[model samples]
Target: MNRSEFLQRYHHLRQIDYEADYPLRKTGRAAGVLIPLIDHPDGLTVLLTERAHHLRHHPGQISFPGGGAEPQDNTLADTALREAEEEVGLLRSEVDVIGALPEYRTISGYAMTPVIGFVKPGPVLTIDRNEVADAFEVPLAFLMDRRNHFAHFIERKQQRYPVYFMPWQNRLIWGATAAILRNLSSHLCDD
Candidate 1:
């Protein structure tokens, strides 16, 4: 979708009192993610990052730029934007925050709030090697397509929990990241 249509459709969902299907999870701390959307020549795309392999939690996983909330952050949006800048050098001024989506509780013990925003793509990103392995964008059209969302699961301690996966280019976008994308799809796209 174009910028205007995207905003219109996205705003339509915001009018209702709604959240994603994820109920409160038992694990993890409070966190927020900046889901950056850029209107590219190809189409609208979402910025995503691959976590540094050395990290103790979710190593090498594809994710949004965010982390556990800190006292310095006045709001979840602040946390999201701060983390985005810290991780990927995404300047706060460049982001036009559209709004936030529902809160999703992660099994790793995080109450994640996704802040959606718009940005301009170029040679503007400076990836922090410590927190991020790489930064990339996947077309929103590809992600919004229901066909691209896959059903998967991991066997943890003999328990099976559903996981979502979206393979874009060579990266496997899955787990919490994919779940957030799925939520956005349900809210902003018909398919």
Candidate 2:
């Protein structure tokens, strides 16, 4: 969808409580992730990042630019913007804060809030080698479409659990990132 159409539909979209169906262990740590949608001439695209391989947590994982909340952050949105800037050099001025999806609890121990935003096309991204290995964009239409989504089951304690996954080219998008994208797809496409 186009920028205007997305904005119009976003305001009317209903929030989906993903945690209601899939419970996760929360560590009481609040986190924020920026789901940046760029207004490309061809179509809207989502900006994502690959975490640096040396990181202690979730290293080399494909994810949104975000991290644990700090005391100086006034809101989760601020945390998202700040992390995005710190990791990918996406200046706050280049993004227009739009809306948010339902807060998600991660198995890794975080109460993550997904902050949605629209980014100006062609924003220069300076990737920080310390935090992120790469920054890239994927067409929103491909992500939102159900055809690209995949579900895999894992056996734990004799119980099977579904793991959401969306493989974009060679990069594997899974775990909380894929779950959040699934939530976004449901919100945007179901209605």
Candidate 3:
């Protein structure tokens, strides 16, 4: 869809009290992730990041640009923007904060808020090697299409937790990142 149409539909979606799927995790630290969309000539593309291989948590996992909310951040939105800037050097000025999805609670003890934004095309990113290994873009249409989504279970101890996986080329987008994408996809492609 075109940028204007997508944004209009997205805004209308946020206004509705659609039931959202949140994980059963009851406790977590507040976190935020920037789900950025760049308007291409034919459609919109969503940006994603790969965590560094040596990190203590979720290393080498595909995820949105984000982290735990620090006290310095005034709100969850600020945390999202700041984390995006720190990890990928995406300036706050370059992002147009349009709207946000409902909270996505993760198995890894993060109460993540997916902050949706539109990014100006062709902004140079200075990726932090310590925090992020790489950054890539996936077609929004591909992600929103349910035919491309798959489900698997992660057996932790005795319990099984569902993981949503959406493959783009060689990259495996799964875990909380994929779940959030799935949620966002449902919100956008409801027509």
Q: Give the winner by TM-score.
A: 2
The model with the greater TM-score, 2 or 3, is 2
lDDT of 2 at 113: 93
Ranking by TM-score: 2, 3, 1
Give the range where candidate 1 is weakest over 10 consecutive residues by summed lDDT: 13-22
Overlapping backbone residue pairs in candidate 1 total 5
Candidate 3 residues 61-134, lDDT tens each? 99999989999999888999999999999999999998888888876778889999988778799999999999
Better of 1 and 2 by TM-score: 2
Q: How does model 1 fare in lDDT?
A: 0.84
TM-score of each: 0.89, 0.92, 0.90
Tens digits of per-residue lDDT for model 2 on 41-142?
Answer: 788999999999999988999999999999999999999999999999999999899889878886676888999999989999999999999999999999
Residue 109 of model 1, lDDT score: 68
Best by lDDT: 2
Residue 20, candidate 2: Cα error in Å is 5.3
Models sorted by lDDT, best on top: 2, 3, 1
- Writing each residue's lDDT as its tens digit, candidate 1 over 117-148 gives 98976739899999999998888889989899
Name the candidate, 2 or 3, with the larger lDDT value.
Answer: 2
Each prediction's whole-model lDDT (CA): 0.84, 0.87, 0.86
